[model samples]
Target chain A: MKLIENWFSERYSDNLQLSFRVSDQLLSVKTDFQRIDVFETYDFGKLLSIDGTVQLTEKDEFVYHDMITRMPFYYADKIPEKALIIGGGDGGAAGELLKLGLKSIINVEIDGQVVEVCRKHFPKLTASFNDPKVKLIVDDGIKYARNTKEKFDIIIVDSTDPVGPAEDLFNEEFYSNVSRILNDGGVVVTQSGSPFYQPRGIELANKGMRKSFPHVASYVAFIPTYPSGFWSFTMAKKSQIKLRTENVEKGEYFNLEIAKSSFALPEFAKKLTL
Target chain B: MKLIENWFSERYSDNLQLSFRVSDQLLSVKTDFQRIDVFETYDFGKLLSIDGTVQLTEKDEFVYHDMITRMPFYYADKIPEKALIIGGGDGGAAGELLKLGLKSIINVEIDGQVVEVCRKHFPKLTASFNDPKVKLIVDDGIKYARNTKEKFDIIIVDSTDPVGPAEDLFNEEFYSNVSRILNDGGVVVTQSGSPFYQPRGIELANKGMRKSFPHVASYVAFIPTYPSGFWSFTMAKKSQIKLRTENVEKGEYFNLEIAKSSFALPEFAKKLTL
Candidate 1:
């Protein structure tokens, strides 16, 4: 008798890959836009992958959610009251913003199957979908950004890689539309890809955002489950980027010191944004 | 006909691993202390591994060498003159120190085979071995630290993990011995493994260094080839750690802002040192 080992691997390129041993795969579905996968691993707990890329793991989701939501909230000029999240079907981004005393949150995700899968497989991340202050809309985020007349104090672009359905989200026309819908002193943040492996992700986002906003900068966070474990985020506003609050207390990864220090990039990464 | 693909992997644990596709195996030797292997990788260029763990790659070696050398050199009370390196058989650390105008450097490595292998495959890193200012000693670093009478301004422990032959290097007795051979106002730094996967590595180094020095702190750098892409280094001295110089210009990763921002830790990692 022979024992076969079960493993799931994400290939970043033809030459590099990361693998995890798994006991079972709980969910696999082909959505209208992309493929979504959920696995129960021995080390990283429940793992979620979209289009064959690791999106989040139960063990390290806090790092991504905390960084994406808290960095711009603390950097805003005032306490933001209303937010619009694009492409965050898992409800993690909305869940984090609910703790910031927001009056309303509207999450616009393109794929309805992604939300259905998360609601069944990942209960913790999707609990915010049921909140009274939260509104979930199943529609194309690009079209919604161009058509929405409702103004928001904060806009979060929580899309996947800048390919397939999310490619248009990193361009100038989408940002120009996004700029018109934001209220005064509004801030917009998006997740740029890994600076080590995908430098073009930051470069493209920075180039597009610079055309629409005066203050545009990129910062990095450590996400062990990502392609290189080094991830980046780009934030922009009409006003200067500065800390407006030191009272951000609901995060495992964000503090006032990190809010300031994360913007200091290494030389190699600095060249990418320029 | 069947075609076979060649690859190399580092098993960080039974459940997690990182793999790199190799075009050729340059060198593979079992030394008296550990196994040393060199490969020509497609994505990361030349790769070096000790005991099946990635020590360095040509593409990202600057990040590790810069953080290990320049962080302490800039944070010192004065410009470092004399230096001691433990287990840097590849001579990369010594090469970086030579650019800082050090008077002399003594590198004590336990495995002499690692030096010979690197001298042939990695010429860029081992070019400093032929310099008159460097003296390479093939001996146990544990015994050398316990018995050396030579006083130095800076000591760098570039050893492997805190297990196997390098187990004793992370204890109080070894640090007390290291304290005896340092000049007044001297600094010592060591590589403490990933804070995400191995928090004990930073905890142990912090506990040991606190017993022998007045000021000790740990900072992190991003090394994508390593297990978690996040790596840490702990530094200690008899005096306060203030910037003594802003003239560090030999690295691609070390800038003035990084020298200060790297010390700011996320909340989870901050608890590991305490």
Candidate 2:
């Protein structure tokens, strides 16, 4: 309880000082959503969805969920028989992965509070957790991947940005661990970084991926609410990893055309191949 | 004069009450470097380099301009020696087109305020205008296009969204006239709305493109700063188009690979095709 008590006394805001709160933070801005109570934090930043400030936007929810879930699933060219979700404490990624016809999944999340908050406020996002196919592990992703003996067909590092508990997710050791824990045909997809401002982040991520896997490539999609307005390029192994789409499943925003174009990085992106 | 007053008085934000000033009948939002102005009456927006926000981002600027200018320049491959750019105001398109080895160009911009602003604030964006190859036309695009009798190899519509005076740019008559004034094998490339949000708008635009040219294909690009995260789409006739590039232009971004990738549209976009 002291952990919560020590971090809860202060708040930070842009020079505007619009009364931001940080109680055991759960940092919530007093905006159009919640005029009051804020909840806890995971490493990267405050999960603002359950309380206020940023809600699951109609387009945002659909875009991120579909892109993150569908890209690697299809690219792997196989229905994920077994899966592991790292740092998705809020359970959204697990929810998406569950629908991919996976046999079972273990979600390794470091923050118990984020899991609890997501299970409660973001019902639609966390809905897939109720499925018996998913098992929650309230543990650090890096340690879990390093310690686990089980090799997964698919590993989704659906963590926050490269700052907090998720910082290690951006490191070489973690990616290498992912490669080690994946089966020969298995593919691991991690959100690299926004292609705009964080070109270097993606460059380093691509570098990390290149070191760990035989074939590595980046995938992109538009997310308006995100800063710099683009999402991280998802990297996957190239051999036998052709994203299969025999049935041509229909979705609101995604399809094979978008899939191909999303992976087709610009020349600037291609130049960053090194 | 009446149009100027009209643009100034009716300027307003989408949801928030942001005071968008109209200087000389064009919307001007003063920033650190230049003015982010909207010529609403013309149904297009202009970001004038009047003050602080003006930047010479060649790699970034070419991302939009070259595609807008040169893509169509190539599509109208036969004898597109002469061209007209309406509402580019920034000279970015004019600059890129000059690289095409076009014989002559007339940049017909209605807002002289923007030209002056760009010369002062956005030297890089406008500096390319000094090329003897380009003749600046400071008048309304609709009127200039309507009055011009000489046919052009290409007409690149580089205006803002379709809600301003450029709103008429979307009208069928504009296409008929553009077709009439276009020399055989002439092609026009107009910027389009995000096919993500405005599928209907893109469909309508494509319908008009087909109305004007016998051949029309939709193309896209990943412009991180524009609304809806991506910006820039093109409609062109492929009959005379020859996009196979031999020169590996010594640039940071635009290259042959991106040139081809730029024309590939997603499934969300495919639905909008005429």
What are the RMSDs of all candidates, in order? 1.4, 8.7
- Among these predictions, the greatest TM-score belongs to 1
Specify the highest-lDDT model's number.
1
* Clash number for each model: 0, 22
In model 1 chain A, where is the ten-residue run with the lowest total lDDT? A242-251
Give the poorly placed runs of model 1, Cα more than 4 Å off: B1-3
Q: What digit string (tens of lDDT, one per residue) describes model 2 on residues A10-98?
A: 11111000111233543343433123334443221333443223323333556676777777777775666888888766677787777
Candidate 1 local lDDT, A166-266, one digit each (tens):
98999999999989988768889999999999998899899989999999999998899898889999999988888886566747888877888999888
Model 2, B191-227: lDDT tens per residue? 8866764565567667776766677777776554344
Q: What is the lDDT of residue B257 in candidate 2?
A: 60
Q: Give lDDT: candidate 1, residue A156.
A: 96
Q: Write the per-residue lDDT of candidate 1 for residues B164-200, one digit (tens) a residue.
A: 9987889999999999997777889999999999898
Each candidate's interface RMSD, rounded to one decimal?
1.2, 9.9
